[model samples]
Target: MREPAKSKAARTIEVINRLAKAYPEAQCELNFANPLELLIATILSARCTDRQVNVVTARLFKKYRSPDDYAQSDPSDLELDLKSLGLYRNKAKSIQSCCRRLIELHGGQVPRTAAELMQLGGVGRKTANVVLGNAFNINDGIAVDTHVARLAGRLGLSAHKLPEKIEADLKKLVPQEKWTLFSHWLIWHGRRRCYARHPDCLHCEVNDLCPSAFRFD
Candidate 1:
């Protein structure tokens, strides 16, 4: 007979223990000095790597240190500055619009709440969560990125596919204080071990607790 499913609490504890031991220093990989920089980086990170975002932002951050700088920048120049990233034109527009709103509404500062942050042009639930968690140290909700979503499914922490539903499921399973860290752990694990096409299950630290382990073997 097939074994009974593990209790949500039990599974969560097991998963957390293994991942925590494996990646004690797991955190957001995107480099940013402040909330505004983080907000801009997260927006530019859509369908892009954190390394690329950091490389671009190193110069972008120096050039546009304040919301007013971005708000007043020439769109063409901004697009040219971000030409290295995919979807540069759209990202530039979003950044310009978001900064303008920031200046108009929050007086050139990043908003502290998800609701308000989402009101910005390029900001969404994921970006808002990243900023709130890392920049503001608020564990409002988990940022369900591609890595988190994939690992959540593989680990059986969440059966849902959509980010919103997956985040909801994760919220129920993970502790409130760990919301932010949980996303980071999963993201780190996904990037390091649980690849999309071929997961390194044999040497994976959470293999024992992971139901999908060694399916390739």
Candidate 2:
């Protein structure tokens, strides 16, 4: 039998409660001191792991302290600094272009709203949501990363494949106040237990609540 909307909403909250307890310290793992640093880190994080991004940013942040620094940096030097990461050249271009737009449009300040964030080069819906939720503490929308998307499908929260659609489905079930934390919770769960290739269903905290539990076994 298909679950009703109200019932599913209730179950979703229960799942959130359990995951929250399981991963109390889950958060934006990419280290940053301010909005601009977070914004730049988020951009560099595309197609890369947060751990790797943090490693590079440890030195990168110290060198490029502001939008003006990135905007004015030599492209080759920036690329050389980011050479260890995949797509170093493209990421370098994105950082420079994004910073230039930030300086030109917002006076070198990271925008507070998602719409304005998306307007910058290389900043998409996912990036904008990350900045909004983590940096600005605004729950404008959920950032549907691969982890969140996978967990949503496994938990029967959404059947959609597109990130925007999955985000819409999640927003309908999750409370507005919890929108940001919900993404963090699902991301933490996905990383810690509900892996894509081999989910630890036997030890998963939300196994009973999940629809796809044990199916991967």
TM-score of each: 0.96, 0.96
lDDT of 2 by residue, 55-171 (tens): 999999999999999999999999999988888999999999999999999999899998899989889998999999999899999999999999999999999999999999999
List, residue by residue over 1-217, the lDDT tens digit for candidate 1.
9888788778988898889989999998999989999999999999988989999999999999998899899999999999999999999999999999998999888889999999999888999999999999999999999999998988888899899999999999899999999999998998899998999998898887787899866
lDDT of candidates 1 onward, in order: 0.92, 0.92
Clashing pairs in 1: none
What stretches of model 2 exceed 4 Å from their correct place?
A: 1-6
Give the count of colliding residue pairs in each prediction.
0, 0
Model 2 poorest 10 in a row by lDDT: 2-11
